[model samples]
Target: MLSITTFILLGILGLFLYLLVKYPDKSIGTNERPDLVGPRGLPIIGNLIGIYLKGFTNFNYENLTKYGPNATSTSLGFGRLIAINDPECIEYVMKTNFENYIKPNLLKEALNDVLGDEKCGDSNENWRAIYLTQKIFVKLFEEDTKKLLNIMEAKVQSGETFDLQQLFFRFTLDTFLKITFGLDKNSFADPEEPVRFAMAFDSVQATIDGRFLNPFWKFTEIFSEGGRKMRANCKYLSEFAYKIIKKRRNDPKALKNPKDILNIFMNAKLEDGQYLTDKELRDIILNLIIAGRDTTAQTLSWMMYNVMVNPAIEQKMVNEINTLLSNEKPIPKYEDVKQFEFVQATLYETLRLHPSVPGSVKYCLGNDVLPNGTPVNAGELVIMSAWAMGRDERIWGADAKIFDPERFIKDKNGLKPSQYKFVSFNCGPRLCLGQNFATIEFMTLTTSLLRKYQFEIMPGQKSPPDFGNSVTLPMKDPLLVKVYRRN
Candidate 1:
């Protein structure tokens, strides 16, 4: 006679076996293209186990390199994924046949909670109309940079090691909030509201990344502790966004200024001649926050890490900034930043090695052949590995792994690479509208800091920090550094 516990255990094992047998490998159907090459997958589960163990960025780069210089195909249990690293293929998919590929429904569903159902909007007009001028950008961010420098000065005076990455995240969040909604979040001071909002924002982003790996995340989210936390975080973040929207709607003063990005959206008319709904405003604001905050912060963090690790590179950057501007005029004007060729080159190099959005996925709306002759079927996924492309020896050079800013500097001006090749800002029609703004911000902040302070990586810290698994390429560990005042 079996005991109750024994019976339950046996039944659970039987159910697991039943699922394995009942579900056929989804990627093994007629849609599987034999010409494409990749790692062999196991029964039912496919390469998900491998991806889980190896990490997303590493797994994609390793397999894509081994199986292809152009493209490779694999399955992640749910469906077939064709990973493309070739520039020509990327251009074809992102540009020539852009209409045929769209954000995957699975991805949209995962992100919909935080980002709302808003596709990229026509932001160029808004940017041009209000904030494109050099003076506006300098005016908008100068005070924020000063605040940041003051905080770093405090750290320097304390003679304590700190995580620059965390500081950068907070700094960018404050600056972006100020520009986007005309609200000074003061994240540098680490107030309760802004800190809590930042934590919730980051937690929700990590949860969304997890969703991409697990097909039955909906069910898991109900029963798991992590899922419950994710739900709570999402709720908090939503409330935060809506609260801002409600406050802005009532503030007639907000309309008169026309300084922030929110006012532009709020006042604009749609095709239907109606003002944006509160929900639309929430979506746009949240999306912009994620874009403006994470990308800039993470890139700055990585750039600093790279500069610290390479002393020669750091010296060159310091000399360039110092020569261009002095303590008398420390904070760079937007035009002054344009002249700091070495600083700009360093930024481009950092982005090439550690793109903020390391990779992007597009769903094929119809069957099509890529420029590289890779056949992608409708319902399949095209995974463009920006990280892989950046590191690829064929695309860059034999010394692609080495950090070199000279690659971007030609005759003392920034060399413009093909959008497909240097795709940190993305390529084609969907090129980031904030490209100019982000560049100016990067150069401005970087020039300002290097002018006054020097950085050293804390002892025993890992060389070339490991990348975290997130929508953006964040350092896995806090980028701890010892700050020093420049003589």
Candidate 2:
């Protein structure tokens, strides 16, 4: 008779053998074509161990560029993953054969656990309602911006060094809550206050990102400490969302006016001519909040970091803002944001280097070949690394790694690059609906802040902060900076 430990070891060995026999590894380039190159993987587990060891971001960068900017392949468990940094290949997956690819079920399940059920197919009415509501609330948004600016000004007067990333996150969250739900979180007013909702939101997003790498995350959620914490946070977030939704639904003034995005959704009808339920409304609002808040805040954080480290670039931006706006009305208005070309260029450059969402994963639906002659079978995962593409010499030329805003300025206007190449806002049918709103919000805040003050890196700090692991790219460490009134 075998002991308990021996029995456990024998069970593991038997499972490994079963997997190996059931799902044999298919060698790449088995046909007449050259093999797609990537880091070699072990049978069954494939590159999971490598990803876990090197860290996902580093592993992606090192392995994706091992053989230049072409598409590379590796196996994860029994599934095949092909990572593409080449512009043409990205276009092929994102645009040309768009219908042949979709968000993977595993990813959907992970997001759904936190974000609620994401409605699919024909959401035009819902989008239009949200857009119109946002347009109407532009003035309110401007007022909120002024309030945040005042907080920053107070910080400058006190001569305190604070994390601009944290400030941006708070500002966006507060503003988004006000505009979307007609509720003022007022996080900017009391910067030190603990924001449990925001913390929970971040934790859930990070946990969801981990789910992409771990196939057995469901089991882990039940047994692991981190996984249990994530589950609790998700519950907290859902309860908060539902509470706000119920309050809004009961408020007669809110329902009567329907000024905020939530009210608009509640009153709006679905494709089947039925009003959107509370659950659907909650999902839409939360999804929009995530979309609107983090992307804008993170991009602003990265943009400020870039400007501060490069004095020349910062000076150019300051000069542009000052020259464009009159002293009487320094803060940019909604219509005025479009005219600040160079300022917009600087924002574009920041996005180019540090896209908020560094990479996106798409699942192949049907067997097809990419433009570069890479064969992709049905049920394979195609990971597009915007981070890698942004730095690829083949796409952005020799100065790809340099922080230069001039790359986006052509003939005194913002140069438009191919959607497939500059995929920060993504491309094709799924292009970000909040692009205009985000731009206006960014420009408004940027112009208002830059006009009054200058940001300097805190003493003993370094440039180019390390990236945090999440669904989005955030600074691993706080972006501490000192704010000073411009002389």
Candidate 3:
């Protein structure tokens, strides 16, 4: 005989079984997803949850290797990830149909404060601002570059183990400050005290990178520790940027004639004859400083490291520079740099292996098919890996992973990867505006340093490049090396 309690327990068990059959798992199961093959995860939650946790660099390599380098795409619970490594597909996305695939909202949220809206600046005003900014950097590169070399000489005098990456950062940052805002903060000379604003600027970027991992990151905007750091960083950097802008605005000489990029924007007027606002000028100069500084520094650090690892390459590069240097000056003249084939190739090989900007991310605007027949739906994030392509055996031959600069120089058949194939500065209309300026800066610094000194990677340093998570590719660990003055 069943008691009332017994009857109730039986009834509950029956209902639970009924519901299980009534509503089975509704998630898009393994191998049942739409034409996309990638890492597996919980149903409807996306296979990319773990990948995002790892990082974009890891996220790209895993997908490309699994789905074949020709093309790949996946849904990351929140948004879709579409990645392709083939040059034809890359050209299609970056060049042929550039207007459609723009920087998605998520990316903008991460970088808008630092990079600004004019990365692909197409308007007349944007063009003029880029033109004026380029002009200023080129004109000032010589003198400011000399200042940087002087600081490196001081480091040699001390002869203590030092961070090469930090020195590069100070050199580039100092150059940007003096060239754009006409402010000189000798950061390299005094490495004991770090700059507050620069520290904040870096913190903001790391937090922003965190946002990309979570699709529902907005929920934590005010709650999480990362969000708190981001808010503080934004406030601090904005204050610092605005202070510089306002100081330049009130200066009398700024209006009479342009002395820097800030002066150009301050004096600039449209056909109606009114100067750009303080906010507009501030964003522009800030964008230039943010975009231009870290990249050149990263490239220089990587190039120096590669030279250390490959002594033969270093001697070849030094010999080329020795032959090219003008008798009057100790360093190669500015125009003579382009003539150094091996020197240029060394830089190229360095970029190929360790691109400053490793990958490209764009949002698909419509249902499109890649050259490789991978279907990309609207609203999916289209990611392409320059890092993977730089190492792909199919594209670059069996020795693709070798650090050989001759691959870039005149080959046996005069064969070389096109800019579209090997894109460190990006390609098409959205191509890096500072490419020429960056190249000139890179070559000038490399020649100057090589002519005067040799860098030896300190013993006990990590071998496979340890990289940090940032918009720019910075070494994960500070590059510690000893510098010797060349005879």
Q: For candidate 1, give the lDDT of residue 261.
A: 80
lDDT of 1 by residue, 1-487 (tens): 9999999999999976775564444333325456877776665566777777776677789987787665444454447887888889889999999999999988888898878876524655655654544366467678888988898898889998888988888888888888777888777775223488788888888888888777788899999998999889888877887788788888898775677788878887676677888888888888888988999999999999999889999999988888887878978886677788888889899999999998888999998999777788898888888889888998888978899999887523356778898899999887887877888888889999998999989888788789876788889898988899998
RMSD to the true structure for each prediction, in A, is 3.7, 3.2, 4.8
* Deviation (Å) of 43 in candidate 3: 2.1
Q: What is the C-alpha lDDT profile of model 3 across 14-125, one tens digit per residue?
A: 8766644532321122123347666555434455566667787777776676675643434443355667888888888988988778888878766676555653223456
Any runs in candidate 3 off by more than 4 Å, and if so which? 1-34, 70-77, 119-139, 269-275, 326-328, 411-417
Cα TM-score per model = 0.92, 0.92, 0.87
Tell how far residue 367 is off in model 3, in angstroms. Answer: 1.6
Model 2: weakest 10-residue lDDT segment is: 25-34
Instruction: Tell me, by lDDT, which candidate is best.
Output: 1
Pairwise lDDT winner, candidates 1 and 3: 1
Flag the better candidate by lDDT, 2 or 3.
2
